[model samples]
Target: MGDKANCNCHTGNAVYGLGLIGAAIYFISQATSFIMGVLGFVKALFWPAFLVYEAFSYFAV
Candidate 1:
């Protein structure tokens, strides 16, 4: 009766997801003040925007 589906893929996905979440938490905590910390967390949630902006700024210079 050992016909159960293997969960290796699910386990791998959970590990990857947790790692990304930990990185996001670290990114959000880099701010020194209450307001900035909150803003940083929001920024982390939408980090692609910041990435694009930084890319543009770097290229524009």
Candidate 2:
């Protein structure tokens, strides 16, 4: 039972870490777009990639 509790705690931490990583990626992408202006077209590519990544990550978790 104690081991199960520990495993649950670790899973929670992993989830929290994933959320933070996703948020950081989103903010960084937005910042890059703002800074690059029209050149942000390249950054636009990242949104789809990010979405795919998020979907995979969520399902994998």
Candidate 3:
């Protein structure tokens, strides 16, 4: 009953955790240099923000 209310919180965390891992793998794989790999790791941490920004730019005039 009351416990079910907290389930949604965990679900969001799981989704974000998975997304972060996937993004890290993708960005790091594409990186050719060690510095680029480090940059990719940082970029992976903010992938969602970059996504939203691109989405807004694409949809905006």
lDDT of 2 by residue, 1-61 (tens): 7777665347766765676566556566666555554345444435556678899999995
Q: Write the per-residue lDDT of candidate 3 for residues 2-49, one digit (tens) a residue.
A: 898666557777888899999999999999999999999999999989
Off by over 4 Å in 2: 1-8, 32-61
Candidate 3 Cα outliers beyond 4 Å, as residue runs: 1-8
Reference-based TM-score of each model: 0.47, 0.38, 0.82
Lowest lDDT 10-residue stretch of candidate 2: 37-46
Q: What is the Cα-based lDDT of residue 29 in candidate 2? A: 65
Choose 1 or 3, whichever is better by lDDT: 3
lDDT of predicted model 2: 0.60
Over the full model, what C-alpha lDDT does candidate 1 score relative to the true structure?
Answer: 0.70
Which sections of candidate 1 miss by over 4 Å?
1-23
Q: Select the stronger candidate by TM-score from 1 and 3.
A: 3
